[model samples]
Target: MPDAARPSPNCQSSHNAADPILVPGRTCWRMEKADRVAVIIDAAAYFARIKAAILNARHTVMLIGWDFDTRIKLEPDDPMPGVPNELGDFLSWIVRVRPELTINVLKWDLAILKMPFRGGTPLVLLDWISSRRLRFRLDSAHPPGACHHQKIAIIDDALAFCGGIDMTTDRWDTPDHRDGDPRRVRPNGEAYGPFHDVTTAVDGAAARALGELARERWHRATGEMLIPPPPVPAFWPDDLEPDFRDLPVAIARTDPMADHEGTQKTGKRGVREIEALYLAAIAAARDFIYLESQYFASQKIVGAIIDRLSEPDGPEVVVINPERTPAWVEEESMGSARSLLLQRLHETVANPRFRILAPVTEGGEGIYVHAKVLVVDDRLLRVGSSNINNRSQGLDTECDLAIECAPGERPEVCRSIRSVRTRLMAEHLGVSVEEVERTEEATGSLTATVDRLIRPAGRSLRPLEPQPLTETERRLVEERLLDPDRPEPMAATILRGATVFGDVNRTAWRIGAGVAAAAVVGVGLALLARRNGLGKKMQGE
Candidate 1:
């Protein structure tokens, strides 16, 4: 394990040509400095800290998300009887123990409806709602098919957590990515393949910004305002060590051209800061761009990537995604988008640095790279709920956090960036950070480092082998059945219903989507069994 010592302070200045983070009205809500920030990798670390933060909450506990599951145990192995581990029960228990504490949970209305199918009972939601202290609201404040796709948890306006992981089922997993791990099973005892994800814990001003965002979302959805929590509770988690201290953090958001009532919020159409940031980050990459996302179905993002690759001295670009997109219907859409994008991207980039690969377990079962992260030249690190797809870019409401070190700010910032990238690669390769750092230094290349550490067994990055798409999939991609870049008109969504790579966050998983077998594949039955999945909170925040 790497040293838990807190990292040095992050850069403070603005207007740097190289770094795009903390730029007001461009990349973030505002350039607020966090008293402390810890980038927790994987669900185990993320979830455990959440539990600790909630337990430590005093006045307010606000959870804003696309999906929520009550059946999930906050800390399954390390139970806290005082709070009770199960989510719904835990919230209830917290309110009971602390009479002054009020819990506010705002989940997407449709996602709340899909709770039962994901192994959660309606009674659980009912219980939380019935408890006056535990306020629950199902948010339905978007155009049809548009999602409230932000995954955020703010406790007492002091501590906040935001990233890919949701407080739902099937999200917990370690870096080992072991084959058939018993702990990776669902509530029904069915084991899921290895899962990979991340979230950032923050305190001080940054936490307040997240709290403000959550409260604003709640007001937009429910038309009820929540007074900012009093400065009563403590900031930061006691158990987890801070990775970066007193660093300026940017909170970037993406909203469709619609308002809370599905009307135009801005005259221009929609907020596309997420998209602009992607373009900026890609353009600014001096050495390499490493990205991991749930879907690769955005043509505009691909176009931007292709632009970078076309440069005569373009940096290496490596993409990490799932080996398979899960649902056959989803495969027909997102899978095809990936293959087609890869096909197009390959034609533009002549270097082997432009590679798309999947992380696999010891037995080669794909470790779903649901983490939406982008590392540009190891100087800019973005972690959030925005994926490489168009929906996340503009259709759905998204929030991402970015950290960019002003070029020459601190030697430690560069070291920290390299450390973060190496840590991520080491997790996927099942090796220590020392090995990855040494190998990467020796090879003088991220791709070559991964190549040398790449293994045929255990955890490793495998080249994503694009499969032959069925006729149905090809047609779906052609028709834009799933990957819509902008929020479609409600009329279109109501008349021509379709789907894309939605939420597989929290503890929930997306196995399949509503498939038109007869029309698409000539099959009689719908291959997709469940619809508990919500569009993802991309991990790049």
Candidate 2:
């Protein structure tokens, strides 16, 4: 730790251009047939795609995520050509088979700390990098206290996957979320909830851009410049065909230090590009807006939705989230804040059309919602590492891809978009679309379906109401929010504090010394200024 007070060389430069200029309004950009796109509705699809991309990589593999679990199985039960079922085993195999190739992994440091009991696999990944030609490092150069939260993977720099899904364990689930699938297992064989997420695979300019992002993160984390891998033979896998064609796509990034540093600022002092994008999508909606996210807090976005609902012509909004927060302190604190935000939004929107829900498995095996997605007007779709929360806005850097379908296209395109949401519901209920429709049609809307699913002995996987907080819970929330080390301000003050303090103190002697030193210096400066003013006044008299 060489003067942690000094900013890392990898810190993003504010002097640089804010971001690649986005084309104004919606215009269809033609995509190559080979540059196909697919919307992975949940973790199952996301994992399958990852396995496929890995098997297809002919030269290099680059992975960047908010978190990466070594024990995760990229392909749960399904096997890929020349790959093992477990993620860690598969990576080892890949390195062994292709000694000449390079693999780079980057993840946020804070996310690693979130897993208190886990061993230092991240450090192990870094050590592996030193032993082999591969490169791995923990990214902490983000605004002090901010997290590098983008989840992306680039194979041979020819194909890439970007989305909210992470390459972590307990995220795997098939489109068929069976009632008692033996395949679904957690610590001590505990059953995990059905999860829904979305990721996009592309092989064109978008893919190249994602590769650029991975490379940038790698350089930032490791202080090593990575040369782009040589173009590999069979860059695009044969089986992976284009899901759609000639669709225009946009790649957006969030940095707090970017343009308009006021309302967009996050805890890390980075621009909240994700928040901006969500608001834009909400405003652009003409029909329905469907979204799936792990958490829904952020008053700014909730306020935006309420504003839209107040308008005479607003799009219907549907949200899917986990039935309850994870049984952890962080989840409990953040989840309560999110629930409050949702309640505020509910108060503003009168109609029953705007709904937020969680996916529940039949027989009351709690709904474990863990997807992040935003589909707007049935024309534009966005998926990536962002959760619908304040932290993702500016505090943590996020990358998301948006696809705009060409005008007057087939309903199948819209169906493809809707299928992601429907598929999640189908899996949870363990029922077909026809049966789901027959049972849910009378109820109408996802909320009604959730109500029906909650009925006694109902076989449907429904979205349940969030559990209410108790008096003790409220006190805990206040404690976490007021904690000096991790102040949960409505704005991006958390990032400011993290950055300003830096590494001023290290040893136990300087534990609280930094804060005291800052306060004393501030007071002395104020006193000196007042004394100088009085002296000047006396001289004038």
Candidate 3:
């Protein structure tokens, strides 16, 4: 991975930070100071840091994600002599080495259906059951159509990770994003495409706050309230340097709750802090806004962007997304929605300063972007598991970490955020960090810099032109058939689908559509859980 040089401590930007964008109760759940925070750019670096942190755990380690594949290799490129490379073996080995340490793994209950196909995972789970120190559980606390989508890890209440990268197969890829890297293969020895992702690591009170969140989730899923581990010295990786030091990190969440019956529910009520933060951040932008997400189909977010673009002096905007959703069903749903939204943006803006682009490797293979990140002109930085999709807004569970800079405060935080944006652009454009910074300085626009730097051949950022959607696709997107904004009862969902297709109920194809809708609500919940290729069967490899 190429390291972007941090700005000098004395360096500052002309655009002084604006008023705080991360507001408690409105934009975030809480704010806590982190002793150190590092943004791990991709899964390879994140996996390595996680391995080191977990190994340093003195008491408890919690793994929470949409899916978990014990067969996936950690640090495959740089394995330690005599140390386990696969995740399951490593966890077992760590517990045995540190008798005081107890590790717990929690994954969405729907993912259990994929366990049989995952190499050696069944045996690994059996082995985990045999060890008293290692425990695994499935999370089914969500409503029928919703799934637990937060990818998080907490170690000893000292260090924590929260973001889009899951500790599962096909997620490990270096920043270089080499198109044919042999290491980018599954445990079954099948190769996958280049992948891009982002996550943040924090140590201090911030980590402890995340620990509380993780514990709450575990309690909700299993009805087992685990006590917080005693606070200990920070166990951040020795070699890793934090992007921001002694900064306040805000925690944002999306927890959907079903309509209650006559009695009160023990679980917490639904919160839409993530959506609020996105809106607040967008509304707060002055110079520019940069976003990278798995899907760009959120109507609320698109409307926010359109509102900004309609302004005479609105900030320039840039987005990074995959060339196309990897799965066919996802393509028809989220993909079509993305197309519709992009079309609206193009139509609404007269002088377009916004550009949505997809990253590709030197060999021209699309790099699957699974990172959910938002940076608003160095005033705020958000990195987490929530995508710009309806499900993430209020239907599914999510968690995001954000750092905000008040006007004339924390020059270092501002510089760090700028550095992260440049680093991401540099990676996508196949250029050096210095080159990106220089171009941005000259163009005075991130989108313009992208336009100036984009190439026709080698690794480049290609503008994503909206595809023409068929009548069916348009209806699917407009009706929000597959991506409802809130927790929906299964019966209501089916009936709604039936009503939508009732006109053609006699047609054989319409019957197939009904079955597809049923499947999406049933087993298809797994596919909707995460768009990072973990949900469905691999098409070829």
Candidate 4:
């Protein structure tokens, strides 16, 4: 058997600062075991793998997400033939054919209320309710401003995927992230921007852990106890190649400390497991840390990075982020915050060891980097839904899976980690993995390796140039709505971040946001009322 298939060799964990093994409760929620693990790079690969996994499910499939769109195609271009390709049709068709199979879907309640605007039809959603076996629930289990943000799918408790990719529209793009790919079109006939994301697939114990998490969430939202389906003998997807086998994969979570009214829930210490892991991983780095995330507005994380960079022999830090934020308020908040953080990181670090970049297609079109991944010193690999934003660190409910090759041991695993990082770099650079490997060997620095592979044209990663924020934007940064340290109400956050925005009259912009927040609550309540009415009408029928 190949070295990748062997059990990861264990190294004695030390609490010593100089050499610490990430511990349970300190750096993570639980250090569970996995029979095999594979890191899927993009949604194009992930969606197909999910389709296959669901097809192979013998008993149950559970999907938990921030949003769910029934229209997205599981296998868009070359769909699975015998059954329909759309996610709803495919799932329902399979269950119809195999009556014993059942699928449970849970999505954030507010997100569900907005689904109609995104092109979901009532008839189709009604189809979901038509099947008693297809249990669908909208989750409203969190404090104000907090979201049930985990994206997870567990099949028969044997295979599971956890990461940033939502099984929804505008999420299926290839590594190339081309601007004009026909498969990138939405159900509404308009093409969306190219997207980039990732997820980790694990079998056996790791899958069971995620399944357990999903069930706990189900109980919290709907008061239904979900039972784990009997384990299946074998169900790994055929196309995927495992990156590591029989590895100890750690699962971590973030649950809001407050209740619906934003008041602190007594005795509920906020789950900061993911945050602890972030700091520990940054502290553990010996050479480099490569990160790709959707948002980067967490001050605590930035402080940790600065601390590491302050070291005389600090490791290089390379970050990949989208050039422009997707939402306007996000730009006002995280975008502004990023500029401030970059400036501090640039001025405070001893040397120019910190670097950030945004990915662009070979045609020079920007491709969004929505993947949440971190690799440190060719030993630690983390892939999941946790972003570097404040909400992901502690406010919203989240799940992240991570694995590490122990310090001073497991050269094979070390090489594998390096290989995964190299491949990712190569994908962004539009070069072969061999080229990345050669560059790494020559330079021994991630920054230098990336600089070497940058081309004049075509797919490549470009340096992220921070933009100057206006005085108003800077004040908003202090308000922390976009980069709130905790999940709280928008109006309160905005008012506070103001010590913090009128670049239009910035006051007008601020007021507009406040009004919008009110409108959203008003909309949420209206929809909630409508949902209740629908429930009553259905009962009568």
Q: What is the C-alpha lDDT of each candidate?
A: 0.72, 0.59, 0.82, 0.77
User: Which window of 10 residues has the lowest lDDT sum in candidate 2?
Assistant: 1-10
Clashing pairs in 4: 362-458, 362-459, 472-501, 475-500, 476-500, 478-497, 479-496, 479-497, 502-506
TM-scores for the candidates: 0.86, 0.74, 0.90, 0.90
Candidate with more favorable, higher TM-score: 1 or 4: 4
The full ranking of all candidates by TM-score, starting with the best, is 4, 3, 1, 2
Clashes of each: 26, 13, 0, 9
| Tens-digit per-residue lDDT, 1-541, candidate 1 | 0111111122111123554444677655566888787788899888788888888888899998877888776676777665677787788887888999999888866564465476446777656655567877676556545677889999888888988888887898888777877777676777777889977888888888888888777766656667997786456666788767778888877877443232345555777778878867876776798998998777766766676666666678888888887776567678887776666566546557677888888787888888989998878888888888868887788888888788778767667767878889888887899999899779998788888999988778898755665444554455555667676664564344433223333211222234322223211111121112112111221
Q: Give stretches of model 4 more than 4 Å off.
A: 1-20, 257-266, 488-504, 507-515, 522-541
Task: For model 2, state the Cα shift of residue 503 in Å.
Answer: 30
For candidate 3, the C-alpha RMSD (Å) to the true structure equals: 8.1
| Clash pairs, model 3 backbone | none
Which is the leading candidate under lDDT?
3
